[model samples]
Target: MDLEVRHLRVVCAIADAGSITKAAAGLGLSQPSLTAQLRRIERYLGGPLFVRSRQGASPTALGEFVLAKARTVLPSIDAIQVESALRAGAAPDRRPLRYVATPGPLMVGLLEELRELFPGASPALRTETHVPTAVDLIASGQQDLAAVVEYLRPVPVPPPPDVVARTVATEPAFVLLPAGHPFATRPAVGLAEFADAEWVLPPNQACGLFEAFTAACVDAGFTATIRHEAESSAARELVARGTAVGLGQATFRSTPGIVPLPLAGCPLLIRQVLLWHRDGPLAAHAREITEGAERAYAAAVRRSPHYLAWLAERPPPGAEQGWAGAGDAPP
Candidate 1:
């Protein structure tokens, strides 16, 4: 059956808002008009499409079925409109690639590389001090991509099925401490040595890396006492002052007054990953930015081969060593 764009817009809006009043508001339609349109559509399909209750409304089984079809058709419709505009020579330039990343020295380098690659394109980047917020941003399609820390030991997270994640780099995490701290002179020190030390860590919502930090300490046979919880950069800053100690990959930039020592004899910790939404394909400009990031990463890895040495360490129980590296830290 032939359907107009308005019908699909109303249906999608209702599914997204879960209330006719809210959906009507979103579509700038009066409640009565929305109700009439929905009824007409249902009549044409010969069935009810929604189940309304006190909680609100939900798509019925048939509505869910229709939504699946709508998703496929709507994109095609959008594509047609875009192509039509292009043919009329009135189409706007493609939008910039939007991505979220945890800020660090390596990240700065990567962005520089991406800028060089896409000299004409404007890319927007947001600094997320926390992983969960970054992940949520990308999952919602608000950000085109995100960089999150993964652990050597796998940890579970709630994400939509279409979110694609991969390990871009695995590096060993160092224990950053005050310059004069006892462990600063050591070539490497294991978690057991710092069992009683205070640590500043990433917020727990950035689950995997946070778990890795505490679990590494636990594996060494003690509970880590969190004195301050923070993002990677702040945690390192705290460590440098000798107020706390933390897990950091070699990718960490040296902050003033902080001495980074190896987390020696511990199972090598590796940063977990890279992620993007599979539902939205990267445009040519975005892909070029991605490639620039890859090139910069490779250059950094070449300069610091310690990650390679750390990758050689045996995997801890329940850990996969597929992506190897020196320190477990953020990319």
Candidate 2:
């Protein structure tokens, strides 16, 4: 008999379950039947796959090699099966678009664009401040696409094995100050300028980028006197009341009492990425959403003179090479 994906699953199941009896129970087969099947599978591969004893099953060197290949292959097969079923039953007017993101102006723009692109299709939207939650939703096929940002802290978020992150845009973190603050009048201010002032720092993220913010302040000359932690609306209120300043994204708005100023050297940065499950149904439209995200970000730059001027003076490295993108703050 020809070896197949099902045969590989049997090898993997025993390794995961750690015993033939447990694997058989999970596979809905008798212990002897599973043993017999495993024998054929091992024979086909020309080796003993797992060493068995009272301690349960463990993969041999050959079993380890085969199991590694199976782990990668299984996810792809499952993704393809899911994509096929959705496309088989989906009607143009009935197919739904699933979108989830951390937060940003790009989400609003992308929603409008997707509506126009697929007029009759339904839309589902979700927000997750925790980046991992959004990543898991997409990887599991529950979400079609995600607008996620990776904070440029020392800790890096490596791309998931089955999910692809396409760089949509890169954006620099900006300083939010009261409208009358003396530093707001300057083209851009350094971290040292706010050394003595009280601050309303952005909420602690799962990514720990707030640490990067603190480190930058340390390099500049002083430690931040953090008075509170808040989201954009709350941060704006605090900054407006002149109680504390905060960090914000390029797209974060300037209210009558609060203003966003570019940092002197653009020290803190984030890259915004569009994520999708490999071979999933919505993978084909990744390019379309990326363009929509760019359009949304461009409109933001037009609105912020400080951000636009800084970019004109020195464009983000990612833009010239391939992309430019975001901070985790509400924008």
Candidate 3:
């Protein structure tokens, strides 16, 4: 049989499932049927794909080579299919309120508030934390709006030429610690205190956040020792289990056995920015949308005592913190 997308899928399924029996079950095929198909594919490809063992199946050198190509081709195909379906069904008179965002639980309530503003236009959010990906999507006209964060302290994260952004709010970053950690009870921690501590940095790279964090640590007189990189849940687990400490958003949720603390001097501050292509569809509404996002951010800030306390000490960015002032004026 000639190799095809289906053949590539079968190879990927087998590699992902790690065994023929499991792959067969996952693909809804009998073990013998899947094995015969796999044998044919191996013959077509000129080598054995997976080596069978008592533990499980593992890809051989040629299998790894084929798997790499399959993984790349699959997502591109999925994207094309999704785009085609959307275009095929899209209405002529109505437009959806499309926006991109990063991974943040705080965005749940914010999204709800935003939906009310653009009535009849169902906005589908695409979550993207990688700086280039968000910028590229906006620049290419794939998405015109995004609610993104930029590290504004120690080093300011500059937006690319393709996009323009206005600061919605500047929120202080917090540190996540195990409940039993020595510094958990401390009202605040000095950046230098974590100098020798193993850290779990944010998974995002090339976004300037990682660079800004490392820069802050260096300014505090030592380089941070980053032992792991992961998403929020894994970072929490690592912190809770006393494996590695990590940074948290100011509006970070109250997780049991975890303490989120402010860093003294407020070395790390994240500016919640509303981004759009400078000349794209959202350009006209950029200020208004940014203001609306700020209102949601204001309500979100109320959930965190740290944000409230921080506001009390310093002036809120972009005119005001509440809907009355910040939301009323365009920055």
Candidate 4:
């Protein structure tokens, strides 16, 4: 019995979480079901793939060897799917580009840009946040593309082993305050000055951004008081009403009643990146959509005096190399 892609995926998830139960939950499968899948794979390989202990499950030496091979073949499955879809006459516009994003000012122009560039294309967009779910959705083929803004220090995420990442932009952190707040008059402020101030942040997957925000405050010798946890727009509302001060990216759109102050000496700026499956060749429409996103990103940056500085030549940090056929313009 040859081990299949499903089996390898189950095994890889187990290795990643180091617990079969957690892995099952992460992959949205029952523990028994996942266990059964693993058992069959081990039987086919004629060896134990994971070593179970009080500490949890760790891939055995044999398991690691098998996984290395599985990794190589897993991507081919996605390629096969793409080819099948293409042969069936899946045009780019009609073909869904499964996209997952967190609603923020950065993404405001993304969809419009896609519409402008690929007029006939209709993207299937879903909203998700938190790094883990976003990564899993892409890996599981639930999403074809994703937009992400992560903390300055790297979070524990699997390397883009089966996916491709493109860094579109980086936004310096800003302290958003009520329009008339005392600090609003200051040209810039440091995180330490707001150590005791109440803060509002994004919820859902955007929750992970707080981790980096907190870490930066830790470095600054103070703890942030979280007043609310919701979407970026909600946070903006909170700051506008003087409920709390909050962090924001340069890509954010300003609400009339709030002002943004530069967070001096804070290295916790948001790094935005786009992700897609490496195994699948992008459809012409999807390619056009991404190019449109690039243009949108470029225009949005140009419209903002602060972000315009990033528009210069050198690549923004964490910006992955562009896709082979997906360039600055549509093919």
TM-scores of all predicted structures: 0.63, 0.68, 0.66, 0.63
Summarize candidate 4's per-residue lDDT along 100-126 as a digit string, tens digits.
Answer: 776554355676664444343355667
Candidate number achieving the greatest TM-score relative to the actual structure: 2
Identify the candidate with maximal lDDT.
2
Q: Per-residue lDDT of 124-163 in model 2, one digit per residue for the tens?
A: 6778787788887776555777887655665555556677
Query: Per-residue lDDT for 67 in model 2?
Result: 87
Q: Which stretches of candidate 3 lie over 4 Å from their true place?
A: 1-95, 153-157, 316-330
What ranking of all candidate models by TM-score puts the best one first?
2, 3, 4, 1
For candidate 1, lDDT tens digit of each residue in 1-331?
5677767767777887898989889778898999999999988877888998877779999898877777656544543443344334443253454557875433556667645654443446777767767776655455666666555554545445545565555556777788888777766777787777887877665546656666676778888788897866677668776788776666555467776666766554665355565554333134454566666666765554444444456542232453333222223
Query: How does residue 76 of candidate 2 score in lDDT?
Result: 63
Write out the backbone clash pairs for model 4: 129-205, 130-205, 167-319, 167-320, 203-230
Clashes of each: 12, 5, 0, 5
lDDT of 3 by residue, 1-331 (tens): 7898778888988887899999999889999999999999999999999999987889999999998887656544533443343445442142355678875532555567556655444657778868667766665445657766666544344556656666666667888999999998888899999989999977874555787688789899998889999877788899999998998777787788888888998787676666666555556555556667767877777877766776787775441221223222245
